[model samples]
Target: MKKIKGIIDRFEEGFAVIEIQGGTKDCPKDIFPKDTQVGDVVYITGNQVEIDKSETKKLAKEIEDLMNEVWED
Candidate 1:
């Protein structure tokens, strides 16, 4: 078993679009936790996906800071 990091890009139909190292991949939505959402950082181990809450929050803050910088006058 191996652990891979990814971000939840979006949900479509019955799948979740995940951004991985090389590109994006789709996995069945049911395989993820029910509370999962877009922008969540996840760790994939075999067929299981687990949310990395701290990483997700850190990423959100980084993006927010970038956005704020861009909008500052």
Candidate 2:
């Protein structure tokens, strides 16, 4: 099956809220890495989810920066 691109909008009750090009879906949160978070882009096909490594790294850094900002003195 063709993989569809999506972004994680949120996670609730162990489900990942994915926002696709034209819609949204709730997938098993465990289908992704433990470090996955909202705004991380991913590719999905059936029950398989493949995260975009570059985008994930970007998001991770963005989150780290945001957290640092929150703790800045």
Candidate 3:
């Protein structure tokens, strides 16, 4: 099985837009966990999708730091 790491970019209609390596892919929302949200990190292995909470938090923190730095006077 091929394992891919991606981020939940957005949701449109009944599909979730996942940003993976190189580009993005549209996957059915039902394949993701019920509590999954935009910006959450995910791992896709074959037909199963799993959220990576720690990685999500880490990425969020990194982005927040960058934004803070950019906005600081």
Candidate 4:
């Protein structure tokens, strides 16, 4: 397993585009937390950081709802 730091770019269906220190890759949004955002920094592990579809969907929805509420003001 490898650990790399990256910033969340956007949610695409069930994946998240994370801009890593050296390259950009797709990771499951659920791997982090529900509060993750476009600019939030994250650490990823494993050979490939892909996340499960069902979990990704659930977390993405939660993140979307949180963003909406946070930006409502």
Error of 4 at 30 (Å): 2.5
Flag regions of model 4 displaced more than 4 Å: 47-73
Q: Between which residue pairs do clashes occur in model 2?
A: none
Ranking by lDDT: 1, 3, 2, 4
In model 4, the worst 10-residue window by lDDT is: 47-56
Query: Of 2 and 4, which scores higher on lDDT?
Result: 2
lDDT of 1: 0.96
Between candidates 2 and 3, the one scoring higher on TM-score is: 3
Write candidate 2's Cα lDDT for 2-73 as tens digits.
988888999999899999876889899888878776888899888788779898788779989999999999
- Which ten contiguous residues of candidate 2 have the minimum total lDDT? 30-39
Q: Which one wins by lDDT: 1 or 2?
A: 1
Give a tens-digit lDDT track for model 1, residues 8-70: 999999999999986999999999999999999999998899999999999999999999999
Error of 2 at 47 (Å): 1.8
By TM-score, the candidates rank as: 3, 1, 2, 4
Instruction: Give the C-alpha lDDT of model 3.
Output: 0.95
* Alpha-carbon runs more than 4 Å astray in model 3: none
Looking at model 2, residue 38 earns an lDDT score of 80
